[model samples]
Target: MEVAIAAAAVVAMGTGNRVLYKLALVPLREYPFFLAQFATFGYVVVYFSILYLRYQAGIVTDEMLSLPQKPFLVVGLLEAFAAAAGMAAGAVLSGASIPILSQTYLVWQLLLSAIFLKRRYRINEIAGCFLVTVGVIITVASGSGTSASFKSTGILWPLLMIISFFLQAADTVLKEIIFLDASKKLKCGSVDLFVVNSYGSAYQALFMCLLLPFLSKLWGVPFRVLPTYIKDGAACFLNMGSISGCEGAPLLPLLFVLVNMGFNISLLHLLKISSAVISSLASTFSVPLSIYAFTLPLPYIGVASSLPPGFVAGAAVLTAGLLLYSLPQARHFGNTFSQQK
Candidate 1:
């Protein structure tokens, strides 16, 4: 029961991270780049802090630390790109679009796994991927209750968002390969989750810092003004002032870093105790919940959003497809997946 609750929390936080981060952009729109950077750096610090504690307790192994950091670097770069693209989409597009487009990652993951990881998926998995693709397109194309300005952003960003998720899929496949190799090589035969998280975040932070100048230029802000931008954005995110008691502009971007990191930790915990299918299903539920959250008349929001025509049905199809895709593996290898680390 506790584990179930934790998994549910993970889904809530996961969806909230996107909805809240997009909300956070209302005020800090000027500092989107820096705010994203802060989230990445904050996660690194938190993960490494816990990692340090574990090390002090003499619970970590040398093999875990030495498990070839290069693959992490590769995945980190992909992560950086995906993060940037997602943040950009959140800023310009509706909260609903982010989840709808992001769900396509599962399809990309399977394709990548087949090509690069040499994994062959069953017919049901392929069919599931096709259904997910159809569902996302249907939801986005219908654009039922999302936003008024999606026309301005056009369909380009959303399509690019799908590609960004494909990058994420590639990263996932690569990381799995790295882990499998490490397990075979190391005497202990398994890597620590914290160690993996810490290294991945560190590499991403390093790359994000490296790209700061470019990002600042794109955001139309100077690199030197990041501190001030973040400061003001934080104040606005906390609702320093309100126009009509609605959340004129809520969502602390820096604070979002905490919640986002929390979501990841919860996901990992769920994965530790259950199968990836469960984790994925929990994540799938976040889509409609996020859409629902966006439609609510929240404090910072000016107006409640409306549900799109087929939003619920489309989401259901996508989620069902994902489940069906995983059914084969779950029936045969559910135990190994739950213990995957």
Candidate 2:
């Protein structure tokens, strides 16, 4: 029952993270790098703070994660690149096209899991992945106007986003390996999810700091002048900016960071309690839901998004695919891969 509740929370939080971030992006229209860095550094500070308190209270110990820290560092670095690239791609791709194309990670995850994690999936699971692609496609393409175009350079950004998400999927698969290995060799047998959250985030924050020069350069700010940009962003983020109009700009990202971190914790919890396949599925469920969320006359949703004609049909098909994939008989398929070990 607890696991079920946690999984449900994961789905809700995951969806909320996205919708809320969209709202945040409204105010953050010109501060993409700031938005990214704030989340990175914010997670580091927030996660490690919780870790410290938990450690003192005897709720967690570093020893539980007997694995070397390097893997998590590598994961963080890859994650940073994936995020930066995805954000860059988003600048070109249509809002509707980005999420749809990003679902390509499902396919990449399956392939990576098969090759590296030695994991196998049932026929239905594979079909479910395909259905996800189809569902997202219908929703995106059947809309009033397609976000991605097939002609000229219109398709390039979506493709880049897909590749970035492929890297993101690869990162998730690698984290799964880390968990599995720790479960096999560590004294507790399974590392705590928060531990990974803390360390992975910390490493990512570190890497982001290291990459600041490059990020600043990309933003056309020189290395020495970058400090002023950071200061200005941090100030506005805290609602201390002189620009009265953008005073609220920082607040949205701050809220976004909090929600996004919660979503991360929920996802890690789901991943820890279940398998990567289930974790992925849980996240996949969030796409349509998040889209539906945007359609409501919610605060900050300046203009409610209209549901495309194919939305219901696509959602129904997606739900069916998820149901088929989650059928209990899928258990047998898992054993085939486990037997290879």
Candidate 3:
């Protein structure tokens, strides 16, 4: 019952994360890099604050904090790059298509698990992967010519978004490796999620600071003007300054950050309590819901946007793929991966 409840929370928060992100971007449309930096640096502060509180409660111990930082460093680096690519692409990609493209993360996760964990997948799992690919093709093709969302940006950004998912998958797998290695180092054979979140976020923020120049360049904001740009973004986010187009302002961005933070913590908590497969399934369940959310009459968006052409067909196929892939994992719960035969 606890796992079920947690999984449900994961789904709800994940859905909010996806939708709120797009909405938040609307107000910060001119400052995607600012949003990205805000999230990265904010995670560092929020995570460490929680870490401290957990330590005071004796939930997190010295040993967990003392574990080798190397793994967390790599996790940070991967996440930094992933954030860069994802934010760049997400700035242009439609909200609905973002979730659709994110489906590829599952495919990448499967491939990474096979290579790193020496796992063997069943025939059905392979079929599920194929279907996921087909569904993505349908979604992209359906909107390519007609929808301004895709037509304006072309296919490059969407493909880059998919590649960002690949990097995110790799970061996730590396975190798993950290957890596995911690078993050998810690007497409890497990580490608190906050410990990982805190350290990884710290490292990510560090790298983000170092990469600021390049990141600014990538976002077409000159490094010299980044401070002013961030200042304007902050003012706009707060709705305090004379910045134009700050329609949604603090409320929208605040909700997005809070929801995003909750979603990450809940998903990680779910992973700790339940199996990774279950955790992933919970998050995956949010994709369709997020797609549908855009079709609603949400604030800042003015009119309720219509569903992207072929969305129903593509979503149905994608859901089928997810279920088919999950079937084998349901039968073999608790094992990180099935042994290669």
Candidate 4:
């Protein structure tokens, strides 16, 4: 029940993360790289602050914090590259196509977990994943097809997106590995989620700093003017200066950052309590929900978009997939409860 609730929170927050990101990007459209950097660097401060609070409360201990930083370094590098690739690909790929392509994340998670964690899935698990992926592809591609976009942009950007997801899959699997290894180091106590989040985020911010010049160039912002661009972005984000197109200001971006933080924390917590594949599934489940959210009367977006023709069907299939995947666990828990009774 605890894991179920956590997974549900992950789905909700993940949906918010997607919606709020789109909202936040409305004002910072010209400074996409800045927004990306902001989130990456912001996580460092936020995660560390929470880590301190948890430590003070005695939920996090010295041993957990001191377990090992090497794994986090790898996680940081993987996340840095993944973000780079994702941003680059997202620049050219049509929004509709991106969601369809993102279903590859599940495939990557499955393969990486199998290889790294030596975990095998039951037949129903694989089928459930397949249904979830298919449902997302159907839901997202219903009203708009990706063929036209692919024809214009070719395959390189799409391939980069796939690679980006692959890197992300590796990062999640490695974090799971860290948690698994931490059990031994902590002698029956697991490392706190913030320990992983803080160190991983700190290292990612370090790598982001190192790659800033390259990233700015990739985003077509010259290195010398990058600081000015970021300064302007901050102004626009805060609505501090007389910046045009700062209608939403701090609220939208701040909401995005907060919800994005919640989504990440929830995701990591789910990963701690469950497997990487389960965490990924929770994240994946948000795709359709986010699609539905965008159809509502949201601010910044001038008009609410209509639902996709296949939305209901796709959602039903996705729900079934989730239930199918949980069937065995539900049964196991039920049996355990009965025995206790």
Evaluated with lDDT, which candidate comes out highest? Answer: 4
TM-score of each: 0.77, 0.89, 0.84, 0.94
lDDT tens digits, residues 154-234, model 2? Answer: 766677788799888888888888888888887777887777888888877777778777666666667897778778766
**lDDT head-to-head 1 vs 3, winner:** 3
Off by more than 4 A, model 4: 329-341
- Candidate 3 off by > 4 Å: 1-4, 87-101, 132-141, 144-162, 273-281, 328-341
lDDT by residue for model 3 (1-341), tens: 78879988998999899899989999898987788789889988999999999999999999998888888899888888888888789767876577667778877877887888576778877787667666655654565453566677898999999889998888877777677777777897889999989988888898888888978888889999988999998988888878999888889999999999999999878867654545666787776677679789888887785666877887788678766765634344486546331
Ranking by TM-score: 4, 2, 3, 1
Count the clashes in each prediction: 6, 0, 0, 0
- Local distance difference test, candidate 3: 0.80
CA-lDDT, candidates in order: 0.69, 0.76, 0.80, 0.89
Tell me the deviation in Å of residue 292 in model 3.
Answer: 0.9
Ranking by lDDT: 4, 3, 2, 1
Candidate 3 lDDT score at position 188: 79
**Residue-by-residue lDDT tens digits, candidate 1, 1-341:** 76579778887888888687766766566556656666777788888999989888866687688777789898789988877676566667775466667667776766676787677767776777677666665655466544545566888877778878888777766666665676788787766678878998899888888877766655666768867766765555555743232243453554566778888878766654553434555666676667768888865557887876777777777777767765644343754543211
